[model samples]
Target: MGRNVRKRRSPLAVRAIAASAALAIGGGGLVWANFYASAHEENSSPNTTKAATAQVATISCPDVGQKLTNVPNKARGEVDGELATLDQQITAAYQRLATTRDAQTRDASFVQNAILGPLKNNRSVIIDRIKLEISRVGGNAPSSLDGLSSCTGTPASQTNAGWGNNGQNNGGQNNGGTASPAPSPSASASAGGQQGGGQQTGNGGQAGNGPLAADFVDITKVQANVPRKARTRAGGSTGTFTTSCGVNANKKFNTDNVIVAPGVSNGAHHLHDYVGNQSNDAFANNDTFAAAKTTCANQGDKSTYYWPVVRIQNGTQDFDQNNDGGGKEGNVGQIQQVKQAQIKFVGSAKSQVVAMPKFLRIITGDAKTTTNGLANANAHWSCTGFENKVQLTQQYPICPRGSTVVRTFAFQSCWDGVNIDSANHRTHVAFADAQGNCGNGFKAIPQLTMRLVYGFRAPTLQNGQIKNAYAVDGFPEQLHKAATDHDDFINVFDDNLMNKMVNCINKGQRCK
Candidate 1:
């Protein structure tokens, strides 16, 4: 794979494209697809209408911007040392992300867990250190170095530049030196700016005033959903070869729920529905989870069902839970539903759709909570009676014969070809092929397809969670889990991504 250094861009725009560009490399196979971010030009545009991320992510440090000129020389040295070390660690992480061979390590999750998490912890430690210093010598504690968490990627050159414009110049710059790896004969580096010279200071990498990206997860290339290998009866490209379940008849609601995307809040930081025992929190709790009511027909089967909570926005521009927040993005109109989903085995697409991996967690939407949350395009719709075709609209198909009402939601199964989990539930997993096959450089774990077959009558308020309401088991604050809501799936069978879940998807056979 070729590597190129890109100029720092807006966090939202960069993440939107990176998340979209992640390619699915399944078992020695590379699913080919064009990856491009329209926001590339907007990154440097001084005249664009786009609102700079600075306006959105105002990471404020307490107003301690005082003239350290009068502070004791010893105190200044101590503060400088602490700041330099912390900056180096954070910079190194971005450097590693920019050049890590293991695709799994090059994301926001890795940045958080392996990089930012530790970096932030260090920040806490320094705050304590600063307090002690101030206690020893009566003076204000410094907080100017508190804004390193947010940033768009920058070249290693700029990152290693001299000491940043902090209140004190303690001498020496802790440069992470995050530059692109050696390019292949075909793969080049630094397409736009001076390639060798890291002189251009952007973001915190340089001491200049460039704002850091709010998000660091590499959302560059969303994997490919190449058409299923087995064509429809026509045996032609025009034919459809997809599957579906559930009678999802309408786009009911789209309110921010607490469950759907956990950890990093999606702007509003709402919760989402999570089935199984594996909740997407930062820590990996016990895999064995308590059981709950399921919509599936098979009794005793307690697989998890996760989705965004929906609410009926009251037309009144006014605001309330029952009524969708008028003019709000999380309102019903903003909800993005899953477009294509299926349950297939964990092998090559040429083979039969087998069982899924046990304890596999698949997140559908971008949990970053940006306005373009649905840009990832993980949503795919289809019906149960018809395996040869797929549907995009909420309009459910009338079942002929004894076919079931299945709402199919296929989650990304392509691991960095490595890690099972990442900071952002997604960076570790990319969507597999329509047939559940992953592309090259990616290992194919058991791809999970949630065929939410709904034989029961649709609730007046169709919440997708345990009850007809949008709230989870304990949280009574939600209004309803209706149609306009979103859906996410997690397998709590085990710790591994591939295991017994394979047997669950009885390829071609109508399963419960």
Candidate 2:
């Protein structure tokens, strides 16, 4: 269902206010030192000048929503609205930053004085509202929230660089850090492309935001790196339950996130491809979900499953080419239809899983991992044939001829056995440890692993430019980094089907 549209400021007026220090900002690249240093130092060395003048790529703000873990149930609705407002503030600020590049070049303190300062003040006010909402509901608001109001600039260089495994294991899968023989110099030369730039360029596809050539790697060069298998316990549930939900062939798409920003239009700031439950939108509640029609083969499995839509940036524009959360927000190109979507639920390696509570909301992977760091990043990118041998966390794999691109999401399986959702939308669900063991007080639930395959021509790197680049839709500030890939799920299975799924998993028998 289409979302209820909310009134928005005129784009021109919003930009004017943003340029005049009235709007809050998010996204990266606005280093004060680099601007001041480059403007004043004429005698600096070539390298010094280059380093000192690197462009601000996007805005980076402390994720305030992630820090709020204790808001009372009664206060959650108000707090969620405020959090969405904060996101809006950042988006506006980033819009200012993106539009005022010339002004920033002319005035060294333009970003600090007009954008970041106003953004901090705006965020501080929003945080205060959150605190007040909690306090009104007899909840103790954490004092540390005040510290999250400030924002920073991420340099263009940092955003384009490949991210390494920051040592966190992702649901017992490969951490994406295994070493292999280096590519030959000639091979490296051919694969290597220009770094991301500030302004729109042929190399940095979507409105100069990205899907940079450097963001891709030749999959054949990666070594076999899947980790050693951890032994399953004697009584471990060893089977799987598969659900056949056709890919979004009906083109079900939206930018609203009902789980995190309910009732807010275009809250995700990116397009999402939805399967199962056809009635998902920001206004959807438990009753709406229960009554919705499903695309799954079994009518009992009405759970909503969605992820960011992947696009091929081959100079083609989609229907949303001129609308918010699409081309207007730097997410351009034609949306690729998924060739196959495999949804499987498997039991734990340690014990049998209990049934997940109906309406349980689970979000796997961090959608802002580029700026938020790798603490919660769970992206897995690979080619069809190389899935077992190599999985990439940061780089998009350049598959060989006849092989398609694949994205996998292994969702959190350990539930806290309490609330259906949490204040931050993540605390109620947890991923099993590397040994597939659920933590104390947490019960194992069916682990959903969604494997989506796309049949598109692999983008080529030639003459230092990308030919048919593709990337997941994301917040404009995230620049389409691979690590920002994520998936969302809400359980709405009919009781009988859910029970059947749990039993199928625990009995170690494959069922469809």
- Index of the highest-TM-score prediction: 2
lDDT of 1: 0.29
- Provide the clashing-pair count of each candidate structure: 78, 8
Worst 10 residues of 2 by lDDT: 44-53
Each candidate's TM vs. the true structure? 0.35, 0.87
**Model 2: per-residue lDDT, tens digit, 367-436?**
8776666567776888989888888777788899989899998889999999889998888888888788
**422-455 per-residue lDDT for model 1 (tens digits):** 4224455665554434456665444455554434
TM-score of candidate 2 to 2 decimals: 0.87
On the 0 to 100 scale, the lDDT of residue 329 in model 1 is 19
Candidate achieving the largest lDDT: 2
